[model samples]
Target chain A: MTIDLFQKTGAFAENKDVARDIRVRDIIPALERHEEVILDFAGVGAATQSFVHALISDLFRQYGNGVLDRVAFRSCSEAVKQIIRIVVDYMQEGMGIDTEDAPEA
Target chain B: MKIHLPNSAFLGNLDSFLRGFDSTHPDHLEITANDQWIAVHPVVLSMIAALGLTVKPGNVRCGPLQARSGHYVVRMGLLKILNIPSSITMVEHEPAGRFIPLTQIRTSSELTSFITEMIPLLHVESEQAKTIGYIVSELVRNVIEHADAEHGAFLCAQYYKKSHSIRIGIADTGVGIKATINKSHEAATDLEAIRLALWPGVTGMTRRDGGTAQNAGAGLFFIKSIASVNRDFFVIYSGSGFYKLLKPSPTRRLRLNADPFGDRHSKRDDLPFWHGTAAGVDITLDQTKEFAVLLEAIGTTYRTALRERKNARYRPPRFL
Candidate 1:
């Protein structure tokens, strides 16, 4: 499942409400079906840390380190990629998991 | 009683002006100002008018204060914006002070509009404008999500052309930091509450009202990181606790009885207490400071810290 984040939430995804909508409507359902979800960040100007955290922190906590395998983030700008990395590392630390061996998105 | 306008109408003097209102006898109060060399920002004037509505309502009147050339036009514009009837008749003109009036952020659309309108007035380039817009938006969102302010949030911004810096202030009359953070953690003092709040991933909204995922708690962390990196001024005041970062070294935490702007470099904690939370950001308008570069640097720092921690956790036991 390829989820174009820009198409889903417009170019700038910073609001938590938009993140909640994306998670409930797209990401969670894809994971439930065991589908490999790809978050496409093409044309996205920026994704705030709060938005990324809201979108995927729960998923990471629920599935633990295994989430990296099922979820792939592509076409991310350096800014967006850094934001995702921060969220991933933050959630990983909270769950007492190490990111040294986690698969790259 | 008649009150005279200060030569410079800046926000720093707001509290002093408010103190002049007589609560005992709201009526029979008058405001007068000699327009000669009087310089007032629009934000300050609008805020004063708003305060009038709250403090004395129709009991106050403005007496004739001679307005020099351009001052008359600006004064009329301010009165029009405040929707206050004025005896002075002048053509509508742009006020000297560039400001966004006090607005409520009830929806995301309103927030977006506010950001769009405010960024241009900051008088910075495209990238710098976007960065400041994001910071302002994030801070206001914090007010809506965390502060729980019944009256919502009030924001005011002013760009000091002479100083080459822009100062933004967001205030809320809400549950405050001590009360909110105490919900999720044991914050014994207001200072502790503020400290914990600034830490990444420490949020009072762990269990959201709608059972949604908790807030990332990185809002203030990001704000502080950017401010410190740029050597700008950032201050957060909640409850009785006041925390200020003046860039470089020396961040102070104090308690204030009122909302007087403390010395940016003061390193004390014995002031009075403010009722709610107020966040202020003062950043130099440097074109070279890009938001993406700042975020990348912050990410690298976080990664390095996490890597070190993980390495320590997994290292073999030390030799005897």
Candidate 2:
């Protein structure tokens, strides 16, 4: 399943509450259905760390290392990609996993 | 007691003035603006108005007077917003073109709308405006997520065309830095809490505390890094600790140091305890720094930090 962030929210998505709502209302259900969730960021212009964190961090804690294979990001700009990388690596380090060896989603 | 508005009511002067007010005093204080060169930012005015809202009616008096230019118009707008009576004679003049009026951010949607409206006021290119929006969004989000402010966050921006700079300020009356971070790290002092808050992956929220899962505590670290790389000035005041990133020299390359809170680079001021946090940023709008470059630089630095922390024999958990 593809989730168009810009369509769901807007070009700029930076609110934790919105991110949490997306997680509860959209992402989690897709994951439960054994479906691959692609976070499409084609039209999104920018995103803050807070927003990115709110969307993905809890998912990692719930699914553990298995989430690495279930989720992927598409059409991310350089800035958005960098933010995602920071969030992923930071979460992985917190979980005592080596980011160097972790699979890219 | 009469309080005079400064010619340049930026963060420093405004903070000092606001801190000077004695809440314990029973008498209402009078605010006077008689200078011929009275100039103030909406952020300052908004803060004063917010402070006034906390006090009883008529406890704060704003007596206005003569000004050389449109200063009185700005003052009048401030009074109108605050609902304070202005005794100064009414003046008919156009408002300043460079100022973005005070805005309140109570939710993420308001933040997004506020940033969209502020881009034009910044007088920058589309891409640069987006970058500024992202930075401002992060600063304001800190208040929303952690401030616990009863009245929400306040934001205002000013463009200085000649100086090629834009100044933005966000203030909140909520739990200060020390109180927030000390929830997880009980031993942290006020300055230490500020330093920890700036460090990569040092988040105050945890799963047990009902914090969002995606919060990796990277907001302030990324902000400070971007400010350093772009040669902008970033100042954060929470509780009694004040942190600032002094502008680097033109020839100096961007480097993330071991002590991100070093006295030489980021001065930590120990002021009287403030009830909440106020952050201000001054960025050169004309600078050709790209957001992509800043993201890459900050990403590299953060990854390096993460690798080191991961390799440590006994690394503490990141969220705590």
Candidate 3:
């Protein structure tokens, strides 16, 4: 399942409500069906960490850390990729799961 | 309540102005201004607007404005939002590339709309717009989701041509930080509540290491990190607790601190009690570090903060 984030979030995706909507309506269903989900950020300008957290933090809680393997972030700008990484790494840290690739401060 | 607008009140000298606020009477507000000139931060206008909203319209009073810059507040829409009849009149012009006047946002969708319209109004570059949008989104959402404010969040911003910085202010009248953080954790004082709120992975919603999916308690941490990297002033006040992140000197090495107190900052737990929260951030456009780099720094601090918090809960084997 390919999710065109720009289509829903415009250039900058900061609305948590919209993020929650996408999560409940699409992402969770695809992951539950054992299908891969692509979050495409080709034209999206930026995304808040809160928005990204609202979108996928629950997946880590429900499906465990394995959800990282199922979700693919495609065509993300460096900024978007870093934000996604922040949310992912911190959630893992809070869960007490070790991550080898965490970046330096 | 009485609030005196001093000659100047930007975040740097905002302490005295905050100290001047009389939050005694809940039914009425008395506003006085410096006779010669009144130049203040956007947060001051937001704070006054937020306060005025709580009072009965007729009960609120503003003495004659002798300041030459009284029209500045008028242009910012302070009088209109509060429904106060103002004697001062000024020609209105295009707001583009200038300012976001006083706006009240109550719902999530309203905030989304405000962000959409605000970027263009400021006429900033794409990268700068991202930072402004992110700040507005996270801050307003925090108020919407947690503050439980009836009047919602009042927001405004001004772009300073001389400094090349965007000054943004947001204020809300709701259950203050102490009440909110106390829901899940034991915050002994409002200052303790502000401290706990700044720490990553700590939320009033739940004490779980990783917050509930909807919230990770990392919003304020990210904001403070952005300002810290840029070496700009960031101020937040709720109840009698106030925290200000002082701009680091240029000669010092740039670093991100998971604990807000670890960063050079000024804190006050004795200020007049504000029923809700008022926050202001100055983003120097030229000094904006690459968004990617800022996030990487934030990632490190946040992850480290969470790990330390998690490890604190671990128990070692006891002696026989």
Candidate 4:
């Protein structure tokens, strides 16, 4: 399953409600069905840490650190990529994942 | 209540103006200004607007301005927003690339729309617009989600052509930081609450390392780090406590601190009581660091802070 992020959050994805909607309404359901979920950030310019956290942090908590393997972030700008890396790294760190397993920032 | 607008009150000298606020009477607001010339930060106006909403329109009393620059506040929409009668009449200039008049955002959708229309007000470059938009979105969302304010958040901004800086201010008359933060952690004073709130991974919602799914407890820390990297000023006032991040000396090398007090800052615990919270930040376009670089610094610092917090609580086998 693929989610067109720009269609949902515009160019700059700062709205947490929209991010939550994408996560609850789409991302979680796809992951539960054992399908890969691709978050397409093709036209997205910038995103807040809160928005990114809302979109994916709970999935890590619910499914553990392995969820990253089933999900893909597509066409992310450098800034958006950095933000996702930040949220993912800290979340894994909070869950006591070893430094070797956490994604690099 | 009485508030005296001094001749000058930017983030640097905003302490005096905050100290001079008389919040004794909860029902009436009396505003007086310097007679010679008046120049103040938008936070000053935001604080007043937030307070004015609490009292009846007839209860707000504004003394006539004798200063030449009193008309400036009129253009900023303070008098009109408060519904206080004013004799000063000035031509309303087009607000494009100048200033954002006083605005009250009460809902999440309102904030999203406000940012879409707000980016063009400063005529900034792409990088600068991202910083401004990010700050506005984070701060306003905090209010809507946690402030419990009936009238919501009041915010405004001004573009300084001379210094190429954008000054933004947001104010809310809610239950204040102490009430919100006390739900999860104990903060003995308002300044302590402010400190805890600014620290990464600390939220009123949970005491867990990373915040809940919806919140990471990082909004204020990121905003402060932006100002810190740029060597700009960021101030937060709630209750009688105020915290201001001072500009570092030009010769000092930049570093992000996990603890707000570890950075160069001034805090007060004895100022006049403000019922809610108000925050103001100054972003200089020329001095702005790249947003990506700033985020990297923030990420590193936040991770280290989280590690140290867990390690502190970790129990090791008895090493005799």
TM-scores of chain B, in order: 0.66, 0.82, 0.99, 0.98
List, residue by residue over B150-218, the lDDT tens digit for candidate 4: 999999999999998989999999989988999899999999999999998889999988889898889
Ranking by lDDT: 4, 3, 2, 1
TM per candidate comes to 0.74, 0.86, 0.98, 0.98
Measured with DockQ on alpha carbons, how good is candidate 4? 0.83
Model 2 over residues B1-320: C-alpha lDDT tens digits?
33456666654355565455443443455666646766664455545544454446667777655567435435435566556655555545433446666666778677777776666666677667766788788888888778887777877777777877777777777888888787676635677788888877667874222134756677888878877777877777777677777777778666874246642355545565556777777777767377777787787788777666556646677995
Tens-digit lDDT string for candidate 2 (A1-105): 998898765777776777888888899999999999999999887788788888998888899857968989999987788788878777766677766665655
Worst 10 residues of 4 chain B by lDDT: B289-298
RMSD each, Å? 6.8, 4.3, 1.6, 1.3
Per-residue lDDT for B172-208 in model 1, tens only? 6577888888887788877678777776556776632
Q: Give the chain A TM-score for each candidate.
A: 0.89, 0.91, 0.92, 0.93
Which portions of model 2 miss their true places by more than 4 Å?
A100-105, B1-4, B9-34, B39-43, B69-77, B87-97, B120-123, B207-214, B263-269, B309-320
Model 2, position B131: C-alpha lDDT score? 69
Candidates, DockQ: 0.45, 0.58, 0.84, 0.83
Q: Pick the candidate with the highest lDDT.
A: 4
Question: For candidate 2, what is the TM-score?
Answer: 0.86
Query: Candidate 2 DockQ score?
Result: 0.58
Q: In angstroms, what RMSD does candidate 3 have relative to the true structure?
A: 1.6
Clashes of each: 7, 4, 0, 0
Candidate 4 wrongly placed segments (more than 4 Å): A100-105
Compare candidates 2 and 3 on lDDT and give the better one.
3
Q: Which candidate model has the greater DockQ, 1 or 2?
A: 2
- What docking class should model 4 receive? high
